[model samples]
Target: MSNNSNTLLGVLAGTAVGATLGILFAPDKGINTRRKLVDEAVATKESLADSALDLRNTVAATVATNKETLDTKIENLVSDASYKADDVINQLEGKLKELKAKNKKLQKS
Candidate 1:
C-alpha cells in the first residue's frame, strides 16, 4: 500500500472514533442520535471501500512494473551468455587447427 492510503485509513478511523464518542456524550434525543449514528456508519463504510480500492490498484501497478524489469534483466543475461559461448567455440576451433598443422609437419619430416 502507498503512503497516501495509510494516511487516509488513519484519518478515517480517527474520524469514525471521534464521531461515535461525541454522539454518545451529547445530550440529544435518543431517536435523533441513533439516526445520526446510522448515517455516520454508512459514510465510514463507503470511505473504507474507496481506500481498499486504492490499495489494490497500487499493489497491481507495482507488481506489473517489477515483472517487466525482471524480464528485461533475464533477456540481457541470456544474450551475454550466448555471446560468451560463441567466443569459446571460436577459440577451440583455432586451437584444433593449430594442432592439426603441427601433426602434418611432423609427419612430413
Candidate 2:
C-alpha cells in the first residue's frame, strides 16, 4: 500500500487501541464512557481523513513537478543532438566539395 494509506491505517489503529485502553481503565459510568469513546472515534476518523487528503495532494504536486523537470531535460537533450548532427553534416559537405575540386584539378593536369 501507499505511504498515505499506511500512515492513515496506523493512525486509526493507534486511536482505536488508545481509546479502548482508556475506556477499560476509566472509573466513569459505562454509558458516559461509551459516549466518549464514540465521540473520540468520530473525531479521529475525521482527522485521519484530512491527513490522507493532504498527503494525496502533496504526492500529486510532487509528481507534476517531476514530470515537468523530466520533460525539460528531454527537450534540451533533443535540441543538443540536433545541433550536433547539423554540425557534422555541414563538415561532411565541406569535405566532399574540397575532394571534388581536387579531383577536377588532377584530371585537368
Candidate 3:
C-alpha cells in the first residue's frame, strides 16, 4: 500500500481506539454508549471509503500523466533517429556518385 493508504488506516484506527476508550470511561448508559460507538464506526467507515477513492484517482492521474510524457519522449527519439538515418543515406549517396565519376575518368585516361 502507498503512504497515503497507510496514513489513512492509521488515522482511522486511532479514531476508533480513541472513541472506544472515551465511551468506556464515560458515565453514560450502556445502550447510549453502544449507539454512539456504532455511529462513530459508521462515520469512520465512510471516511475511509472516501479517502480510498481519492487515493485511487490520484494514482490514476499520475499514471496517465507519466504515460503521456513517455509517449512524447519516444516520438521525439524516433523522429531524431529517422532524420539522422536520412542524413547518413544522403552522404553515402554523394560519396558513391563521386567514386563513380572518378572511375569513369580513370577509364578514359
Using TM-score, give the best candidate's number: 1
Clashes of each: 0, 0, 0
Tens-digit lDDT track for model 3 on 18-78? 9889988999999999999899889988988898888889999999999999999999999
Across 3-101, the per-residue lDDT of candidate 1 in tens digits comes to 787789889999999999999899999999999999999999998998898788888999999999999999999999999999999999999999999
Q: Per-model C-alpha lDDT, please?
A: 0.94, 0.88, 0.92
- Candidate 2 structure, TM-score to reference: 0.79
Q: Candidate 2's C-alpha lDDT? A: 0.88
Off by over 4 Å in 2: 1-16
What TM-score does model 3 achieve against the real structure?
A: 0.85
| Number of the predicted model whose lDDT against the real structure is largest | 1
Error in Å for residue 76 of model 3: 0.8
